[model samples]
Target: MNKTVNQKAWFLVLPVLILVGFSAVIPLMTVVNYSVQDTFGNNVFFWAGLDWFRDMLESERMWNALGRQLVFSGIILAIEVPLGIFVALNMPKKGFWASFCLVLMSLPLLIPWNVVGTIWQIFGRVDIGLLGYVLAKLGVNYNYTQNVIDAWATVIVMDVWHWTSLVALLAYAGLQSIPDAYYQAAKIDQASRWKVFRFIELPKMAGVLMIAILLRFMDSFMIYTEPFVVTGGGPGNATTFLSIDLVKMALGQFDLGPAAAFSLMYFLVILLISWVFYTVMTNLDKRDGV
Candidate 1:
């Protein structure tokens, strides 16, 4: 005799489905509507076909912002990934110090994004901020407001300080999951530190490393508030990434049609990259017998 499956469990998820439809699907549909139409005041909208999309595709301003965003994300990944791994490796594996280190690493990740920006903004001031004051006192001529290089460095360092903890935490979790047997076998073989890390540790951490990479990539690409608060996209628009540009179009200039088009394209780029990362992660899991 075959046993019947209970289908009533489906009802349990209905409320969540309704909530997502209202929160996500409806808003996405509204954006789609705005993307293909032009609107004036008083809710009057005219069909513009793909005019806004074509215009966005051709806009040099958008292209420049895209270039800047790609550079920033690339820099962040290059610096954070290895640094996080190194930190995780050096952390105490067991004891009170391990718990203390974990807590310290988590503190940065817990701070609000806007607050991180504000803290950095005040902290980098050339005259009043400690960093700026020290640099000025040492006659380094540091001013993020006036110097493009200084502004870029400040933003990059701030991001590293704030988000490196996340990478460390993930890597630490990956490290914790490695069984003692692996270490014992390596030790029995008289394996060197580098060899053990290369053959044993790195391979085991691959899954979590990929996850950390994907999360960091998406977050860095879509970063807006922190950089916006710190720089205001100033110093001649040196730090204005795609998100800031989209906001300027949508709200600053009140160009809804183009802004919606820009946003959709932005979403597609992120979706495509995320798909690629997911594919890599799945393949890694298969190879690692995870």
Candidate 2:
């Protein structure tokens, strides 16, 4: 006799399916619909076909924003990964201080994105903000609102401050998962600190490091709220990324057709890059038997 498979699990997942349909699928369909059509007053729409997509692709504004976005993401990954690993390596493996450090690291991640932006915005003001005031008192010229380099530097530093803890916590968890026996074995071999880290600890942390890199890459690439709030894509668009450009096209300029097309392309670019990153990293992991 054949045993009947239980099907009740489908019912358990039905609510999530419905939620995703409403939250993601429906909105995506709407964007796709808008992308190929032009609308005038009173909701009259005409077929625009690929005109908007072509316009966006040829637009120098979009290309500039994409470049800036890539640079920002690259800088973030470079700084956060190494800094996070250093912090993790120094943390106490088993102690009350470990718990305290974990809590301290989590505090930054707990802050709302908009709030983080706001805090940085205020913190960078030259007339009143502590950082700007202190810098000015020391004869350093720092103004994010008006200077291109300052704006970029402020945004990068703010991002590092707000998100570095996430990387640290992930690395810390990976470090904690290594067995004490690995350390004992390394000690018996009279391994140097560098040798122990290179031969054992780094390998053990590979999986979590992969996760941290991916998460940070995606987040930094799509960053909007923080920079938008802090710099408002100011100083002659020096800090304007793709997301800000899209918002300006859609809401600031009210070019719905172009904005929709721009958004679709933006989504695809992000998806493609993220897929490539995942593929490369996973293959490396498999090669090393991670």
RMSD (CA, Å), each prediction: 1.7, 1.7
For all candidates in order, the CA lDDT equals 0.94, 0.93
- Model 1 Cα shift for residue 243 (angstroms): 0.9
**Which pairs clash in model 1?**
none
Task: Give the alpha carbon lDDT tens digit for every residue of 143-166 in model 2.
Answer: 999999999999999999999998
Candidate 1 local lDDT, 1-290, one digit each (tens): 99889999899999999999999999998998999999887899999999999999999999999999999999999999999999999999999999999999999999999999999999999868999999999999889988999999999999999999999999999999999999999999999999999999998898899989999999999999999999988788899999999999999999999999999999999999999889987986787675
What lDDT would candidate 1 get against the real structure? Answer: 0.94
> Cα lDDT of model 2 overall?
0.93
Off by over 4 Å in 1: 1-10, 287-290
TM-score of each: 0.95, 0.95
RMSD of 1: 1.7
How many residue pairs clash (N, CA or C atoms closer than 3 angstroms) in each of the candidate models, in the order given?
A: 0, 0
